[model samples]
Target chain A: MRATEMTPNDKTNDSTEQKIFDAAHELFVQKGLDGAKMQEIADRAGINKALLHYYYRTKDKLYEMVAKSIIHQGIPIIQKTIESDLPLEEKIIKFVDFYIDLIRRNPFIPLFIISEMNKHPEQFIEKILPARLPRPEIFLKQVEDAVAAGTIRPVNPQHLLLNIISLCVFPFVARPIMQMVLGMQKTEADQFLKQRKTEVTEFIFAALRPR
Target chain B: MRATEMTPNDKTNDSTEQKIFDAAHELFVQKGLDGAKMQEIADRAGINKALLHYYYRTKDKLYEMVAKSIIHQGIPIIQKTIESDLPLEEKIIKFVDFYIDLIRRNPFIPLFIISEMNKHPEQFIEKILPARLPRPEIFLKQVEDAVAAGTIRPVNPQHLLLNIISLCVFPFVARPIMQMVLGMQKTEADQFLKQRKTEVTEFIFAALRPR
Candidate 1:
């Protein structure tokens, strides 16, 4: 097998790098950049401090790499989905479903991204985001076209977009408070989030229905 | 006047305490509990470290006071508004308008609260939140009655409440990204938030309109 052909040293190196990356990602999400420590990350990765530094020289470098990887992971999929040739209604349904599921799988991302953005807006904008962002122009124009054709009610395209994204993202961002106030267990919270896929889509369409 | 009658020492003490409180609030909002330092807060307050410690014995105590003050300031107003006897539409309009305005004035509160909740849910829920929370039962019941009376379309009351809050709060929470993606200047962001009061209310009512 190809794996057997590789040296044992190569396999160990690959696994060590994976462990460091996973540990760094988890710590960065749980604690903000300034709060997470290099030594602690090393401990969590089950490696010594020297080996961690050998792979990633500094905490900032590790954080930057992790942040970049997350953004890269999300941006392309969003761009392709929004820029697709599907009709606006279908596009929205797909976007909400995809976004909610993505956040569900990586529940910490929303809070991590938002907190980092709050702490350093310029770094988030210039360094973390790709040169070409997920273009919303296509999505905005689609909404405008829908309104012009009297397909949806006359609404500010920007506000409409914000509303849709807000409905999908806020629940996860505010999950602790949501769980506390609603008296929801972990299982119930999962069920509520799943239900939002249908509830949010229908709510947006209902609001858009011509007067 | 009562101010004129006060001893000079009393006035200075009052202002000094106010300075410490304001400085601590600013630092806590910018950096989370663990990241904020007493010496930095003292410097920002234009006081010595000894004075800061004299005023608030420990960083934990200061943080608890700030968090408690923030929750207390918001809870009563929200409770009064949501529990008011106004019609459902009027109640929603009032809630959204009041909430957006509250957040606009205190832009850091949502992120601060949510971050603290994420970091220490037990501390936030058990200690910081008042024994009596801002009750949502009345609001939820109103939504249910509206749906039953055919005044609004069939919808889960919990989902409806979440939608209204998500629309109101998410914009502020995600303002940095929103500004970047939409290419909004500070002035434009202000205008957009101001517009949401009307926009969100109308959108919610439109969605709830009987089919």
Candidate 2:
């Protein structure tokens, strides 16, 4: 049972390097950066320690690769969705859909992020920044337009952004507890969470719409 | 210095264990659980490893003490806050206040919870249920009441509750990057987070209030 063997396509010249990343990500999530070991990563990748270093030079460098991969995977969607020409409510729906899907694709993304961010937060956030989408001025404008038309109450765009994220992200981050407390089974939890895209935007708009 | 020395009024045979917990809490935050060492904990507590093992048995056991202590500190507040006769809005306000103060007092609390929770989630959740608040049904009913009375837009109460939590918790868990992104120093971050209690409650109430 080779743990680290990869298909030829996955290797390229970077195959060894890629193996190191795959191992690092798994170990990082399971045990955190400090708990993860270069030796273990080497072993997991089916390579010797020298070969592991030959690819990535250092543990920190390899970790940065994984971290960047995560941020790149998650952040661009938000930037594009919110900055799109979609309608206000539709933008929200798309935003929620984006995160819910992202979490499903990467369930550990939040825990991985929250844990590592807490460790060397300066490093994590800095890594995340260059990838940050341009301000969703369109989303903000949509929100203002809704408020002006007396469709929603006046609310800060930043706080509104916070609201959208909280509903979408929190459940996935707290899934184990949420599932237990809310009496949901695995499939049930997935379905209910998927249903949240519609539930959340309507709820927020309902709350904000002026009389 | 005599390791395991007791205070003049100390009588509990658990003093050594208590010292270990206090020391572990500080070190876990300072160096993380993995980074922290048994010897370091011993040095800080002024106790020997033999006594530590005598009380807790292993490093995991010692960590359990810290996790349990943090859980004990917060869980009752959730129960009492939810089970109380306070009005919904007031309850919301108080919960925000409680969480903010608690997180502030131990800035590392959320990170610690997320970390250990990720490490052994089944064990953690089995030990302390996040939904142990008796009669969460009451909060649910209140949300339904507001929705039915048209005092607020229709919302899944659970989603709204989740929203409030994410807004409050995420920034702290993501403190390192958030500070960099917002260009805030530690004191500035403190003030920014401090203001969130009022901001989060009002934001929810505003968004949820009847259109």
Candidate 3:
């Protein structure tokens, strides 16, 4: 049924479905698709196995839901930020700050998404990613314009986008190893990550600055 | 038994053990510790499950050995490169080129190591890593000395190190998603990555260049 047509009982059902989604997302992120068990997800949701089955018939279906939810939630925000009217340097600062904060709030998402994509890129790229994937053309064009206008040095927009993202997302993806290598505790790690927003922004601008 | 003390029959046993290790490494990287099955690994090694168990009694033991093997092989190469007497600019180029190539050849290892580390960090950080980890002190000190001498702009050496590694490693970790986003085929992806050695090196040096 459509959301506008939902009755009170449907709203109650929606809350239960949300609970299942929350539980499934947590388990999937923590243990991945193959490693996460449906029974455990049901238990985590505080619902019985039968009810969990009734809501989502299989782990695969639930996993698809969780993955879709993440993409749907993230893409719009990204599109808005990237497609914004800001200058390239300001756009980059905004992008880095926003992305670092987003990953910090959802620490496991980068690794979970990347690992799942590695395991099954056919499914992820074909099914989970919407037909209207977030387009970087506008952002790429802005980068090209910046170079032409001599606002920034000439560089490949694709690599620049990848560099910005890599700088933001990789620390979180490699957090366990980073923590171990840097000899950082949880608090220190948080502090280090907090510093990266400004650090990353400056680094990007410095790199882009015309000689 | 030590290699020097091994009997003639021990050579055959060592070869069988090597087969098990290779098969286990492949499966573990592809399927992870929980998803990879012992029987599958045994079959991949062209041995019966009994023989596999005779070589390594449990999956955990086998997984640990594989993880350690990866570390033992990689750390020395990394230490040698970082501790070399090259100038900082040359060192950064070498590090980026070597690392990107290493991950390209072993495409799955980045995600495998990061995901496995996320799953059981205490075990991975404490046990899998050798007591004498590849230290970054020499590299960090070099960055500091360069900054003090006005050879590069002032930047946190830790963040700089992280950025360099992140630029090198994150592409391989996120290759599938990157391909989908960049609308590139496998060959294109390979070409893009090949270009990154120069792209990444120039970007880092540009960022580090003194104003």
Candidate 4:
């Protein structure tokens, strides 16, 4: 529910170019960069290879566009949440809530980006960050403010941010293992995730509360 | 550090068959099942195609063996940890410690298993679990005992397990993104992970402590 304010642009639902973009995104995320094929993406999009090339002349270009699109859809929300005027506790809760929802919707995105990024770090840094880079400074300052106010125990801001991000995002990213370990059916797992909205917020707050 | 108690059988390090197994594992994990080639695996192992076939007849057979080996190596350690008689808090800390070490050593294993499981869930359950399945009862009992004793808050054991696994394993699985978001160079990220041995334990303890 905390994610209501932010809406990710789902290109799959939009225009012809967006359909091509969305199809490419799905293929790349599911099959990875090397495994993904431009012809397959075109076929999936129900478009000719010529038109697919018209929108994206190369596989690399399509991959970069999808990565940038994903980053643009998700990172700015985090940047804005932390950069907002909300208090630390509220901001942290909002951040976690929004992120869990985002990842739930785009389960493969974090893995897709991370795998592709490691394979092509230089390309990702050059392509993605310039498009819509995350502002860690905004988040770091909020953590610092919370620590300063004795609202939370002293911890490195980066670690704290990483902790929050990990807790919110990992379940979605690692859903298969989670389902196995938790022994839940898909619908059951969905219900469990719904419960995490409050459970995760409370857990983070409890961890951060000054002793 | 705690993982010293449990060692994953490195079939990779033992015999000619193992070299094939290890090489196949590396290719399959990195490139995935469809993207991996039997001949390429033979080349990576410095062995002949016929010899590779002599060890494992088919790609499907080889993939299953690798999956079983990975599950056998990792899942039992978790089962043992939860089944241990340590006090709840100490047990939780030890579980976290062992898992972080495990994932730190084999960063891609989690992503590999999860991705592969999503693609071939039935095959994994039939092949991997029958070999060395995790027993959730031990973990559930421990959590129930802790709750009954007022040692921790009354949270669902499955959720708690998911949270612990997420907090411990996620940073390593999503290392590229973690490095980018936290702005850490590879060495710096390694150092940060070292610190998580303590930081993650403390955070979990803080969250679970009875209020």
Best DockQ among the predictions, by candidate number = 3
TM-score attained by model 1: 0.93
Off by over 4 Å in 4: A1-16, A49-51, B1-16, B48-51, B129-132
The whole-model lDDT of each prediction reads: 0.87, 0.72, 0.85, 0.78
Q: Please tell me how candidate 1 rates in CAPRI terms.
A: medium
Candidate with the larger DockQ of 1 and 4: 1
Task: Between candidates 1 and 4, name the one with more favorable lDDT.
Answer: 1
Which 10-residue window in model 2 chain B sums to the lowest lDDT? B1-10
- lDDT for position A10 in model 4: 43
* Candidate 1 structure quality by residue, lDDT tens digits, B122-179: 8778779988877788889998898899999999999999999999999999998888
**Native-vs-model 4 lDDT?**
0.78
Residue-level lDDT of model 3, residues A11-83, one tens digit each, is 3544877778788989998988888988899899898887776767667777887898887877777778888
**Residue B101, model 1, lDDT:** 90
| Alpha-carbon runs more than 4 Å astray in model 1 | A1-14, B1-14
Pairs that collide in candidate 1 are none
Candidate 2 chain A has its poorest 10 consecutive residues by lDDT at A1-10
- Residue-level lDDT of model 4, residues A1-211, one tens digit each, is 2121245444356666778887888888887777788889989988898887776667777787787777788777777887787877788888888888888888778777766676567888887766445667877887898788887888788878878887888888777777766678999988988888888888887787777
Q: Show model 3 residue runs off by greater than 4 Å.
A: A1-15, B1-15
Those runs of model 2 whose alpha carbons end farther than 4 Å from true positions after fitting are A1-20, A38-51, A82-91, A122-152, B1-19, B29-32, B43-56, B85-87, B126-135, B145-151
lDDT of model 2 at position A111:
77
Best model per TM-score: 1
- The residue-by-residue lDDT of candidate 1 on A128-176, one tens digit each, is 8889877788899999999999999999999999999999999999998
